[model samples]
Structures are given as structure tokens and as C-alpha cells.
Target: MKKVFLLILVISTLAVASQLEIFSSSGEWAFFENPARLLSMNKQGVMGSYQVFSGEGESLGTFLVGLFQTPAPNIAGVLYLKRSTLTESSYRTTIEYDAAFSPEESLNVGAGVSFTMDQEERKEIDLHGGVSGYLFKDVGFGVSVRDFTLWSQKGTYMGGTYLLKLFYDSSRKNRFSYSLVFDQEVLENRIDFTIGSEQKAGLGVSVLSNTKTKENTVKISLGFYATVNNVSVGFGTFIISSPVSSDPFSEYYYTQGTGIKFAVRW
Candidate 1:
């Protein structure tokens, strides 16, 4: 019984620690991070992705389904559902809806709301908002807030997490971007740097630091994307650095895992 309890505790800790590191604001998943980016989509499309993270003895799987549409000349909206499961008895599901409005050609503002439910039927609601626009001819910036709880079965909180991102696009088809994320609730911060072409392939590196423990984790990703006749598909993989565990039972902490992603839009 003691060993079973310890195993559950370890898995829960790993899931929480890895949650922030798995998703990216670049590529097809941009709307997942900043809803304001949906304004850039000109056509209505549906997309989905499945990802798995695995370690020595356990694995976690995530599935996502989303769609975006332009309702008016300058208004766009997206709706998505995400599910994460560690075991049949342990899972979480979230549904999110976001909309962006462009008042001018170069500027957009957006807001989103999400509802989440866990295996135990605990429910939570979160609000998000963002702004994105061009600063220079080919330079742009985005700012967003995530996870401001409107209500929760556990409790209610204010102060959502924050993200700031900047990007530069060259006429030659290359784009470079940097993002910084601050999450006060967990006392952790993350930085992501990516270089890629909107036409083909890209590479990215991310560093996540725990302010309280002063420990840092590094992750690397590579992906390729293609577009044909208004349809787009993308594939990517990532690997994370492992953390050394001091636990007497476990040799290596499960914080490190490899994952792959696939997404398509039409």
C-alpha cells in the first residue's frame, strides 16, 4: 500500500512539472498559447494533434482537436478541446473558446475562456486575453495572460500567468522568435527561442527554471511543415533534459520525456 501511494504521488508530481513545458506558441499550436494569433488566419480550418510522453516505467498521452473560422471581415474565433490521460483512472479534459478582433490591418486583440474537469469531477474555469501587432515592417510582438481563474471547485484565484513574445520575419522566408513566460503560482519561469521558415522546417530550444528550487530544464525540438492548395500539415518531435532524483526508490525522475506532434488544417 505504501509503495502504491508513492507511485501515485510521483506520477502526479511529474505530470504537474511537465505540463508547462510541453506546449509551444510557435507553428500550428500558436492559438493554444495566444488566442490573438488567430486573427492571422484568413481561412476556416480544422486541426488536431496527438502527443505522447514516455519514460522508463510510465507514459502520458494528450489529444487535441480544434477549429477556427472567420465570422466577419475582421473577426476570427477558435474552439479547441484537449485531453490528457496518465491512466484510465487519471485524466483531465479542457474545452476552450477564443475570439480575436482586428480593428486595423496590423493590430489584433483577443480573449478566451476555458473549462476544465478532472477524473474526480472537480471543475475549474479560467479566462485569458491577448494582444498582437506589428512594431516595424517585419517585426511583431504579442502579450497574453493565461489561467486567471473565474471559479474553481478547489478555490478561486486572481493574477493570471503572463507571456511576452517577439518575432522578426525576413522577406527571405525565415522567422525568428523569442518568448518569456512567468507563472507566479508555481514560482517558475520559461524562455523559448525558435528559428524556422514558415515555408518548411524549424528548430527550437526552451529553458524552464524553477525560482524556488533554482533548477533548470532544457528542451529541444525540430519540426517540418508543408502547405498544398490551402491545406497544411506539420510534424514535430522534442526531447527534454532529465532531472536527477534523490528518491531512494526511483533511479531517474520522470521529468524527462520525448514527444511527437502532428497537426493539419484545411
Candidate 2:
């Protein structure tokens, strides 16, 4: 049918609008928080992170402004901005706003909107919602969904994504934690899995693998941080390796990058 053909064409044209692989903020576990984590009043702050792709030729930068304390005890909000550049020819920018609510200690829910623009002047909008909560003793689960629409001169393209995360908190008072995250890019039929562990004393590690790609690329990330005068400073690095590519004309098979972040409460 005409509708089926249009849908397929739209998905193919907007596949390039997929999420970017940027370094997490402060710690590798930050990726788990980016999509759905609710904000607590005690944790409001401003932070910025920058990362390079493949050690060169690509880079991403992000800034977060959070409002954790308000007249209402159950509401919080955040603003996120991100920019990325690839090989000097392609660039993208994203801006999003999220509002979160906690009805009780065991439940959290949020909704957000995001807008993105690329080098070709194409634009896309995303409407997302998420839910997360502690299910059992020290164990938690989260789920998030995103509906995206791309506006082009030819027609409009629609896509969707969903993510699931499971985490364990060993000590609620800033101790040790571990989590597993899975992301599904529904429209594109791609999936990513990640595992990460962190310590409040400022050390963490993470690993990510893509299931739908033949390139066999794996990303490993490490991070450490410390606090001084109520300010937190973090340093992190990422390494990407792929064993299947050897041709000189192929993309970089091995790449390493470093990033740093600083945050303070006010």
C-alpha cells in the first residue's frame, strides 16, 4: 500500500537522526540517568561535559541546568543542551526540557520534549515519557519511551525508541552501585546494551556493545572524581575497538578519547 511504502521511506531517510554516542557526565553511569532519572532536591546543580570522538575528527559537548528544589516537594525540572560535530562536514544540535515528579519514595515519572537540527537544516522533534522506581530492597527498574517526528520538504517521518534499565544500590548514602541498561531504537531495529558500576568515592567503569552491527565495535569507559569545597570535578576516558576493519579506506578501527566535568550546587 501507499502508506506502507511511505513509512518505509521515512524510516530510511531519518535513520541518520539516531542518538549520538557521547561521553557520560561525571561518571559512566550518567548514561543511565540521561533518559529518565528523576531529580532529587538534595542533588540540584549545574554541570558541563565535553568529549571527543575517536580522539579526533568528532566531538560532543553538553550542559545541564537543573532545578531540584521548589515550593512543591514532589516536582523537579531540568534543561539539557548538546552539540556535536563530525569530520567537519556534519553537525547536530539538541535541546530538551524535562519535568519529573515523585508521588512517593518508590515511584517516579517524567515527561520531556526535545528538538534537534542537523547540518542539512533538517529538524526533528521528540516527545518522551519515563517511569522509574525502587521495586525491591535496594533494587530498581526504569523504562522510557520516545516518539520522534522528522519534518522535511518531502514529507514527515516518524520513529520511536524505548529503553529498559535495572540497577542495584548497595548503600543509599553514597556508596556503591551497579546497573544494566538496554536501548532499543525501534524504528531502526537497532539495539545497544551497557553495563556499569560506580563508587561514590569517584571511580567507575562501563562497557557497551551494539547488537545489530557487523563492525564488532565495543566501547569501554572509565571515570574518577573528587569533591573540594562543595564542588565536584570528574575525569573520564573512553576507548573504542573494532577488529573487523583493516582497509585504509575504512573508518578508524581504534579510537580513544578523554573528557572532564565540573559541577556545583547553588
- The C-alpha TM-scores of every prediction are 0.77, 0.65
- Show model 2 residue runs off by greater than 4 Å: 1-36, 41-44, 55-71, 150-161, 173-215, 243-254
Residue 208 local lDDT, model 2: 41
**Which stretch of 10 consecutive residues in model 2 shows the poorest summed lDDT?**
185-194
Query: How well does candidate 1 match the true structure in TM-score terms?
Result: 0.77
lDDT of 1 at 37: 76
Error of 1 at 24 (Å): 4.6
Clashing pairs in 1: none
How many clashes would you count in candidate 2?
Answer: 0
Candidate 1, number of clashes: 0
